[model samples]
Target: MSNNLALNIEKIKKEKSGIDVLADIYFHAVFGEKISPENLERFKWYGIYAQDEQQNYFSIKIPLNMGELNLIQLKTLSLISKQFSDDSLIFSNEQKIEFKNIKIFDLPKIFKLLQEVNLNTFFEAGHTVRRVLTCPVNGIDKTQLIDVEPLANKLNETFIGNKKFENLPNKLQIAISGYEEGCDVQFTPDVSFNAIKDSKEKILFNVKILGNSIGFISPSQVLKTAIAIANIYKDFGERDDVEKSSFEYLVKNLGLIRFYDILNSTINYKIQQSSFKNEISHPRKPRLGINESKIEGQSYIGCKIYDRVVQSSKLDNLSSLLEKYEANRVKLTHKGNIIILDVPTLNAQNLACELEKISFNPFV
Candidate 1:
């Protein structure tokens, strides 16, 4: 980090692309492919969960868009948990899956296996744009006004693989949601867009920077606005200290209005000041319960689990229960709860009891 190679500590893996090298590492180990110090450091960028704190073993943080997980992916996670990390799939507060206690040599096989189910551990950590989070309820809940899944996915696609953004000053946390009441850790992100109404009552997102309301942008313009704000961060965010160069520090030092105007200037349009006024505070609502979907006769059963600790066997059991009860999908909540979506009304209590057997009681 102190060398003349790169000023930023986050973007030092230049010998080969991180993802490609992971594949190479997996296949070339017999030919003396060894993990360099820099390669090991860069692994976190792709959600490779090796940590100085955890030591030797690693964890892969697989992101879930709106915490959405189909049955196939759930089975994949169960397999990863059962084979690699004991029997637990730890749920991150960001609505992602963490596969823990994995050996370094087994990563390529694991990554290849996850790819079969259309999942990859990409950009879940480091200075890059981390995971894109949205309302967990999404299309399932009556409380949600617009399903921002598309927007979240679009943002994910726009930011995750882009090398230009890989070396920003520090981690740039972002959240986009259509939840009127505000879900998904709204205020804590570096940039947050929460859906709201204008004077005409049309749904538009009120943009907030560092938890302070800046202005509003239309739904179609959300992506544009996101890119603009990101560019502003890349351009103006301080990089000297690295530790103090996070988006929050940039906002704090530059002041809110200064950063707001910078964002507006970058996008080449004025952000209309929003008339809407409300501060959301529920970090852990809808944590455990039978949530009725926006569609009648369907319900989502949510269960509270440890934020960072999970038994691999219990997760395998959870996947089996989902299969047994005919649930189509599961979503992870920001509060570290798991939501089994598309359940019939008749099967709701049964799902709860089954989860209870695994000690993840939905009722409690």
Candidate 2:
């Protein structure tokens, strides 16, 4: 299509108010033709983007599962990449796609192409699950006694897909942590499962409910089994009042037994006394090389993320430094801290200095 055609198409799309009408106009403008009713239903999954004169862009929300991006979506994105000004396709920090630097006139063509290619299946925007964050390493941590990834995934699937979870009283945060120094941000989550190892090497998990980042950081031990714990939250979790909703609020008002009873019906396992103890260390003054790792001769450095904002620029620099310094992997801690594992003795001091320059203090 010509540049003028693209521009005019985008103008019409932006002028239209609702997504359905906008999509219809877009399809006609792009193909110089019409779309069948069945085809329109297929296009519902895709989103729209329009750019105004100020270089700002807007996205129409689309809901899709969070997994691997499909081939069709990739192809649509590739088309957008060619049509748009920049190469960068903005994946929002919350994991949604942003079409960058496209003129308002091109929106209809882009939207039509997105529909024809079935790209909507991969695009999800304005969805509430965006508020929930899970560590990729949740169940895979070598130090973890139990894998909580399954439970976390189950919770997300149920919460997002089920109409009941959409009405949640407040945004709920959940984390699964394994290791003496937890990798998952357990402290900040409303509900957290931390894996603990006993003297006999028996691995059991403790469910912490109602833990918050603010002053109300009350850590209560609830269920030992992850499934039971998740079910408990789902059962007692208030959906009517968004303001008063949260696992913490429910547990506080209903008391333990009442909460346990609700979850007990769904969970087959027996509720055992929590053998898990609060083994996590309190935060220390910001410094380098203060916290040692389980691996001998290795230490961790805490980098205060700028305003707790994790950026690609900082991560890119850290990735390069890790390779240069012989660090094995970078672990993001729940407390908004990043850990560089397996630092060699010879490079530890130098690495610390370099990290300090980047606003990260080596554990002292």
Candidate 3:
């Protein structure tokens, strides 16, 4: 470990209370900075804490809204990597980054980097769209309703620029997937949409509200058609409290009738109940299997990313491999998985073997 990290750990242990030692240590390690006593007190208001293990290792539980550590911040993280253990920068399941191993002396430098880099631009408060994750495969799926990427981008742009939406009391999440197999795990979001085939064979988007993560997991009947539903949440969503600021809470507080009334008024599209048979299913379940996509003849393999935090260099290397191997296309699944498509079937086994060498095991 770097002397900077060692000194940071010791200083945190000495100066901060048991609950704050982790955040103070992490802030220094990653940004080379420290939180003031007052800010630390504020963090406590959110129930964040520092935890220590038998190995004397410590970590901080960060909220989800703090998701925007950009490319510049990532470059700065390279400095942290050099000065600390490789495991020091850990990404949580919710996509939050945790920095381990920091020193008090490094605090000023970390603060300088935070200020210089303006890291606050990336941080979101409660129930904002910061945690609204999506699969790159959203619109490209062979079976999907209207392309949702445009809508998703619009939501992101609106949230980032619209100060009116920022001070909501809580965080909100939204997910859209066009596949029936539920590959994108849309149900896990605060508000979710899944594309389904209607009786007429036309594709219609099903809106699921308060589906998961805030107490309600029941797959409600399609709340409204896709475009209208999106507009509804975009216009009338609540952010009253970060903890209770999910679509579920909104639906609970204002019954679906009133909610749809608000939604119908805001959107131009008709609010029609979906004619499709609603398959009550969990969204996060895996859709791919040996029988799903015929892979016996393909050279390239699909690899499931545990979290979407692979290094940029690794992505570049994968691209290079695709070019070298003449793999012409890459597919991103809603499940946060990547598919390197279109390789000679004869070479598939060899390619899979090579990928496993890099810790990417094909789903057998």
Scored by lDDT, the top model is: 1
Task: Mark the regions of model 3 whose C-alpha exceeds 4 Å error after superposition.
Answer: 1-125, 136-147, 184-187, 197-202, 212-246, 274-279, 282-300, 304-349
Q: Which one wins on TM-score?
A: 1
Error of 2 at 231 (Å): 5.0
- Candidate models: Cα lDDT each: 0.74, 0.46, 0.45
- Whole-model lDDT, model 1: 0.74
Cα shift from native, residue 124, model 2 (Å): 11
Tens digits of per-residue lDDT for model 3, 251-312: 66777566656756664554464322334664433323211223344443566666455454
TM for candidate 2 is 0.49
Off by over 4 Å in 1: 1-24, 27-34, 49-56, 184-187, 274-284, 306-308
Compose the digit string of candidate 2's lDDT tens values, residues 175-294.
555543344333455555555666776665555555321111111222234335444555566654544555667776877556555645565654454423333454222233534544
Q: Worst lDDT window (10 residues) for model 2? A: 212-221
Query: What's the TM-score of every candidate structure?
Result: 0.88, 0.49, 0.55
Per-model RMSD to reference: 3.1, 11.1, 10.3
lDDT sort, best first: 1, 2, 3
| Residues forming the 10-long window of minimal summed lDDT in candidate 3 | 212-221
Task: Tell me the tens digit of each residue's lDDT in model 1 across 238-262.
Answer: 7766667788888788887777667
